[model samples]
Target: MKSLETKAKEELRKAKSDIFSLEYQNKKVWVKKARGTFSSALHKFYYKVFPFEVLIPVETKTGKETIAFETAKLDLFREKGILSPKVLFKNDEFFILEDCGKNVNSYIRKRDITQEKMYYYLNLLIVQLALIHNNGLFHGGAQARNFTYKEGVIYAIDLEDSFTNIPLEVLQFRDVLLFLLSLTKTRASFDLDYNYIIEKYIELTNKKELKQSLKKLANKISFLIYLSQIKLINSFLGRDVKGFFKLFIILKKL
Candidate 1:
């Protein structure tokens, strides 16, 4: 039997997908390939169109740079006491991460999951986000699907973004917005109290700048909420808009 590291190297040589899972040493790990040129370009294009200061996007890296960037991020988060997958192996074209567990989105979507259980995980996610912010770091992608639950711990993943010369508060503010936006994608969105989530986050961190950033963004985008009332707007986007508005309202109050 080959060692897991050797197996990973062999698998990376033939892997086609951008990401996949492998089993070795009785443990599962994820292998990720660097983003291709076209995909990297497309990602950068989207950010160019949106150019919000609080939402400033990091330049998309490709090839070996992508592997290096994410590996550094995972290490940074771990150093800051935030939970993230341990990087098992890395090279120019590919990297491997220990399987954290079921994605938080999938866990919440489980048919047997109760509302109470859902809130429990959601709260944990928020707490983790707060801790990240408090440490002066931010998750460039804070979506529910980018988080995983394992053994009573929630781990952050998909950290492919990096920033330079940006205020820490701005990055942290974007994290809060991304997290709020993600909640709208789930069935639990309708049942959740957006104000409570905002309040909980605020309670966990002393970052006054983050609260002010949310307030400023909410005021600027308040007009878009009216569009959600339009009949033609699809249910999914409408929920997201409404959820964003609710979070904004809570921020304004704070």
Candidate 2:
């Protein structure tokens, strides 16, 4: 019997293929069979982000096995009180997690993102992030598509690159930027001064008095906004497709 960790490592092969291959028609989905090289961490990401069809169970000639939902990692996340897609199935070396119901990105792309409703949801998103980080984990890849909303509440997903010792400053900068970036895509890019939208949320959410959070949010993006054209590039969809690789290459030497 293969341990769940072993099966998860095996599934990580070709993470990008699975992410792009997930097909959703109405509420049903068909996921591609894993057949390429993707890091185990990223495979964990795909499983958390999307629901998939039941495929043949994977068993090695040596008698190792893979199963869904019952994996140790899933249990760990659930036990921590973190919000993610609910697990649906598990059989040797495979698992299916729930879908977002509706994407958070779609809501951000709307015309009137500065509406009070938008601010309310965004602040709620921020509080959820604060709570998750307090539990000793930070979602390294904080982006709009990672958050989801259904009914009147917000849910977070994906936990592959989290850090247990995340600095409060870093977490504040990261979470604030993600929320701001969503607004930028919808409004700020048009020269609308949307800082008030953020300020209002901060005012309403009676937490640990987020003054430092507010300050860092500005400082982090000061350079990006000055060179907004450059910082504005989509992390996933770059002009060169692999343009981020070149940017990272430049960054590594500096």
Candidate 3:
């Protein structure tokens, strides 16, 4: 007479042996069995700016209860009314989530995006983030890959890594900074308006400090850009100096 929870745990253990339970439309659903150590918060920032995933260690969870912990976190986001995947099923190994929609990258690839449209979508993404932070939550991974859009609404995904470990203010600002960095990847060549985006986010949240936070971040980015210009520092940091300068230019324009 095992309880339903117990049964689910048993299924999760079995799932580790056979990773993928289903697959379709180039999207594979499986329990990623290998658990690795978590990255430091600093590396999370580098992850947005650098192409060093090849050298990064896998996320190795120290215990078997990791999946359960992740499942609970996803449930909390849904309860908070944040747009994210709904848990369809769960166990200790992995949980099946309802497909929210196409991720931002896929949605943008469908056609040539006008600068106006890019700005509009970027503004919407930031607004959604404001809503999440307003609810006292922080999306640890705020890159475009972790977000999807459908029917005029944006949804966040990959809650397993989302957390509240840092202060709400720091986390909120990191989310903003990371998201802006992500847009640089997509629309690097476009003459985008960073000021409008930041202003609108501050307006939506009514957080005056957001503007200050962004200013400080812009300064730090500018420093990085200068370092990137140094040949020795550039080689040591493995930074795309041009990319750093580009991002700094965008932020400075704000």
Candidate 4:
């Protein structure tokens, strides 16, 4: 077995690859390049069953483009005094980064976090995302899985999906929606109120527009859930039904 650093360097030299992961100095790092496409068995199965292209998130840029984009994004976060990973080395094919720590999902799952602690952590994530949006940027995939906690601080990661092509308003609302959806999915039992989370985000950003957009989006999603519940539409639009009802419960509260 090669050292993690050696593997990382080797992967960077490859012409084409899908995902590369290795550990260096007791820290884990990885790269995701397009070596064809990857999807879960569930996703593939559903596509065959439905045979319709759903409007899904796309990464049009190659791994090289993503590396440069994320590198610049990291610099921007640091300049704005936000906590995130630091780039150790980068090139067109891939980049090496300082592993921040366990993602929020892993941390929460590994320990029994108190309700108070959970609220604190969630609020911190919302505020950090709010800060990023307030600075006129958006993390395309704003989920707990993309956030890390270490040494009493939360760090954002998986920024290759960050983008600025859309209007800031749309992206801001999208950021909140994506986050709440991800949060609800992680919590198998709908034990948390998403409204308070959005309220906190609105408070941090002081953006009344975000509050309005959030309400509209929540209501729209809630209606879809209603349709699914009525069998008028397929759960997850014929995709994953694992958390559809849970998401409905979440949106209703919102």
**Alpha-carbon lDDT, every model:** 0.78, 0.47, 0.62, 0.66
- Between candidates 3 and 4, which one is better according to TM-score? 4
Compute each candidate's TM-score over C-alphas. Answer: 0.83, 0.50, 0.70, 0.73
Error of 4 at 123 (Å): 2.0
- Candidate 3: what lDDT? 0.62
Q: In candidate 2, what are the lDDT values of residues 13-73, reduced to their tens digit?
A: 7565433223233344222232222235555565355421111111222111222212344
Q: Which residue pairs show backbone clashes in model 3?
A: 35-60, 35-61, 36-59, 36-60, 36-61, 37-60
Error of 4 at 7 (Å): 5.1
Q: Looking at model 1, report the run of 10 residues with the lowest lDDT sum.
A: 35-44
Better of 2 and 3 by lDDT: 3
In model 3, the Cα lDDT at residue 13 comes to 65
Tell me the TM-score of model 3. 0.70
| TM-score-better candidate, 2 vs 4 | 4
State the lDDT of candidate 1 residue by residue for 96-166, as single tens digits.
89999989989775556677898899899999999888887888889889999999999999988777687
- Which candidate, 1 or 2, has the higher TM-score? 1
The lDDT-based order of candidates, best leading, equals: 1, 4, 3, 2
- Number of the predicted model whose TM-score against the real structure is largest: 1
Highest lDDT against the true fold, candidate: 1
What lDDT, from 0 to 1, does candidate 2 have? 0.47
Tens digits of lDDT, candidate 3, 42-143: 777776665332113225454345556556767887898887766666644445666666778664433468766776667768878888888887776677
Error of 3 at 236 (Å): 15
